[model samples]
Target: MIKVKVSLRPIVSKINLPTVVKTTILPGDSIESLFIATQVGEIFYIGNGGIRTFLDIRPRIIKLGGSSGGYDERGLLGLAFHPEFYYNGLFYLHYSVAGTQGPVAFSESFKPNPCDPKTLNQRWINRETQYDHIDTVEEWSLQSNGQPQKRRTLLNLRRPFLNHNGVNSLNFSPETGKLVLTTGDGGAAYDPFNLSQDNMEIAGKIIEMDVVKNTFINNPPVVTRFNELPAPIQETLTVMAKGVRNIPGISFQRFYNQYIKYVGNVGQDLVESIFSFVHYKPIPVTQLVQASLMNSEPNQEGFVNFGWRGWEGGFPTSTKGGCSENPTLDEKTIAYYNEAVNTSVSRLKPLTSYFHKDQRPDKFGGTALTGVQAYMGNGIPDLTGSVVFSDLARVEESRSPVRGVLAYTRVRTDGKLNDFSVIETDYNFGSQSAYYVSLGTNLDQTKLYLGVYGSMKVTDCNQGTVFEIVP
Candidate 1:
């Protein structure tokens, strides 16, 4: 990797935490405009040299940061414009619904132990009253008068934890022309119930929905699994992949005629990984349901898996503790030996994996992966045709004035793991903490955007800034 340096041009400042930042052409507009979706259910766009509120659904969003000590992962997490938005004025949104929070699924934190079979095979029972919150997907259209209105409800999902709901979760696939939704494993540590690998669970899978085929259901049932959905609604969905721990979002980079899909899976105490693939076979929800009812396995020959709850990036999932005798050293134990062996051959290898604790002088330790985008822009010549990503914050001993990290990596032709280089930026934040919360690109991938927050708490309002990655 080559050394790259860029400048952050501030677009807007003093706003709420942004979850999604992308460009789309508004109805009757001649050029594309940058749209920013905040975690508190507000969408703003920059047009005619000023920021304007495009939509506000705060009344409909669940109360955020109440149970998590002011830090939250469930709010307005997704926003996507239809491919024909300029003419059709259609768009989609994914967010946690109001008045739907429930009791925690478990009384205590979860950790898997290989010696105890019961701990390894815990089940999520009494789901109706034992969950964290409900997230809803909706379709909205821009009216002729330029205001956005809700068109229909697409799907409602039940999450089991307060975190790992996935940030920037909604996107449109350029190849198949379908809306893609990437979800995290129902969020206790180590996926206590193994939801990611289960074919019936919807928490940790990548699904595609055909919005063109309306199911005519105004109020869809809130469910946790594939078989519980209405038949008509199930017919419009297909599962693309599973075994996800948590994801920032998915990106599609055009390569000749096909698009190379890029996904960043946030790691659990080990390594942050980025996976790329150009081919996959998505299984329809109807087929999965039929197979479940018959007690048979669906054809998973061409399906994709990220190998969660077993393997974390390039290493088998393990627990770490300090060595009693040798105080300077740490002890590691494999968390799930059988699961690692079972998924070893089926999971896709990541293109690149960065460690949580790196000793190399050239590399920095990563905390959590927040965003990933492919930059095809010529403004930063060295970063053209490369995949760029953002970390919430680097791992360091000091806590004050925390700063995030930016890095870039490329796909290799030999299908081997590649290394990345840090991208230094020219910006002065003084003594304020800056956490990179989100990343986005234009429709053509010719421009890049970065969302930075001054604090980690979503309740700390008016502490965000949107910046353009410029040369």
Candidate 2:
């Protein structure tokens, strides 16, 4: 890793919290334009020498930051343009639907006790009445008149808790030419229901939907599992991987003729991990449902699994507690010992991982992985061909003004864990907290974008600024 320092040039300011940032050309445009999607359900594009509203779906978004005490993960979380958007005028969105909030799956915060078997194997029952909210994925098109309108509904997912419904969730897969949706392990801490490893659970999995297939179901049923979906919808989806805790989004980097996929799995308690792989086999949702009905195991050869609930990054998932004998030392108990062994061989190894608490002077402790993208731009030569990522905030003890971290790492050719180097930024935030909420790139990934917020709360309006990482 090389020491890299860059400048943050502010492009847009006074916006709501940005959850997704990317670039796409409008139907009639000749050049690519930057688009920013806010958590409060507004999409703006930099065009005509000013920030213009591309779409506003606030009325359709669930009321945010009320129940969560000024902070929330439920809102407009994902936005993506079609691969052929220049000709098709198609795009997709994933957001928490308005008027669908319900009782949480668990009445209290969840922490698995390894000594108590009941806590370790709890199931999510009474799902219909016990759920947090519903997230909907839909296809929208920019009409000939230059107005965006909903084309059809793709998926209506029932989420168990308020968090872990991924940020920057919707993306178009270049390899398969399908729309990819990456979601979290239905939110409660430590995955109380163990949904990630379950074959039927829709949460905690990377799914690819073939948008070309017209299922004709304009309004899909709101369901938590794959078995509950209509057969037509099931036929169009394939599961790329499972055992995800929470993900920022998936990024694809061109490597010769193939694409290298990079995914950042937000840590549970210990570490934040970024995994890269060039090959995978996706299993159709239909086959998984049929296998469950027949009580047979579907062939999982070439499948990708991150091993959540059992393994977090490169270590076994553990619960941390202060040591009784030593007041300063923390004790960690393996949360799921049995699970760690079962999935050890099948799960994919992370390309790089950074700790929540690091003692190294050169590394900063990570709070949460906000975004990850591969930068192919030559503008910053040191960061060229590297995977760049952002953290919500660095864990600097007793720091007055909290600041987020920007770092880069490279994939190893030997399939082993690699280290990351922090990319120092020259921009100063002064007294305000700057939480890096999201990261994005242009159509060709030759440019990088950073979304910074002054506050962590969604209720804090007009505190966001989108910047470009420049030399």
Candidate 3:
């Protein structure tokens, strides 16, 4: 059996409003690099492989909105090394820029020149620079060995919303030399026009493209929907999957044929879930909503639809759902109800979900199943192939007796979701909090390095800290 332990370290502390967090060991090198996307700055790179330190890279300022360059939710939000990182000094990044305009028409979206003054958005009228953003993914040149390189945008994104601009989680499927990216819904809140569910637009979809060839998986129709172009712009972009909301972390199984796990942070109202999208299935099926619920009585059977606006984490001030005589007034609640009833039409659900402290924290979010896998491909002592997750404690808010600790379950190779193991981290792990745990290769390698970053207010402080769980 593969034994795993957690190690806690304060890589960085008191850093408020941290976004995308990614970890990658240098290719063919032992240097581990942790990339963090923040709102205050562009991107921050921290190394803990051979040494321990943090490095920040602020890219050249690009005009946003339609004029001069500025920052908002628009900054470097994603970072990834090319599959052949050793060969191509090329790496990819995604950032939003101004100097651009939109709603011009959807089909001919990418046509407006970000530099054109007349084409800028009305919001950029006074900026003297472009108001629209030119978000792109570029390839960079790395130094000899696996050192950081000078970046160049390979693909640019011109998203509608300033927030939910989306981050790129790149993974190379060896089975197919395709690079897969799971992007969040195009905006921070609800997508009214359904840019995410729209098959034509690339804004809110999980896309699959050939990084080796730098092209789309399938050719899509060319027609402008929200751009100023007289005609549609010809483009080659493919959408492999659709309907996802705010996913920052995605990892492929170490075993070639296993499933790909997606750890995402959802917006308020809905529950955040860890999705295991199996690649080899006839249709990639996943499990959602696994957390348990607490009962007011010994056996009270009731259902609580998380009211995003009315009640956050179950306090009930009348924000999200059916609180007033009319529940439809709550936009999020209406959206949730419409979605849940239309399961046939919706692909969104939480394999595991949790309730607020009032509802019950002891039942769900107590523990979840997770793990590190050691594929038997090359045939080594494969000790890393197993399930592991965090155990929940009532540190932050313990309403009733702890029914069960947070337990992360795993679906075995037979495609059965079963209870695996639980981890006890002496922390509250407040509502919707998640941990990104890495079980390194072996003893000679590193065992497990678990770190967490998310919104956790309510304490004396207004912000939260990113911490490593020490075993």
Clashing pairs in 2: none
Distance from true position, residue 371, model 3, in Å?
14
* Per-prediction TM-score: 0.98, 0.98, 0.58
Per-candidate RMSD vs. true structure? 1.5, 1.2, 13.0
Instruction: Rank the candidate models, highest TM-score first.
Output: 2, 1, 3
lDDT of 2: 0.94
- Greater lDDT among 1 and 2 belongs to 2
- Per-residue lDDT of 1-471 in model 2, one digit per residue for the tens? 789999999999999999999999888788988999999999999987899999999999999999888999999999999999999999999999999989889888888877678888988889999999999999999999999999999999999999999999999999999999999999979988989999899999999999999999999999999999999999999999999999999999999999999999999889999999999999999999999999999999999999997899889999876224665667888989999999999999899999989999989999999999999999999988899999999998889798999999998887778999999999989998999999999989999999999999999899999999999
Backbone clashes per model, in order?
A: 0, 0, 68
**Candidate closest to the true structure, highest TM-score:** 2
lDDT of 1 by residue, 73-138 (tens): 899999999999998999999999999999978879887666667988999999999999999999
Q: Global lDDT of each model?
A: 0.92, 0.94, 0.39
Worst 10 residues of 2 by lDDT: 320-329
By lDDT, who's the top model here?
2
Evaluated at residue 321, the lDDT of candidate 1 is: 49
Q: Which ten contiguous residues of candidate 3 have the minimum total lDDT?
A: 282-291
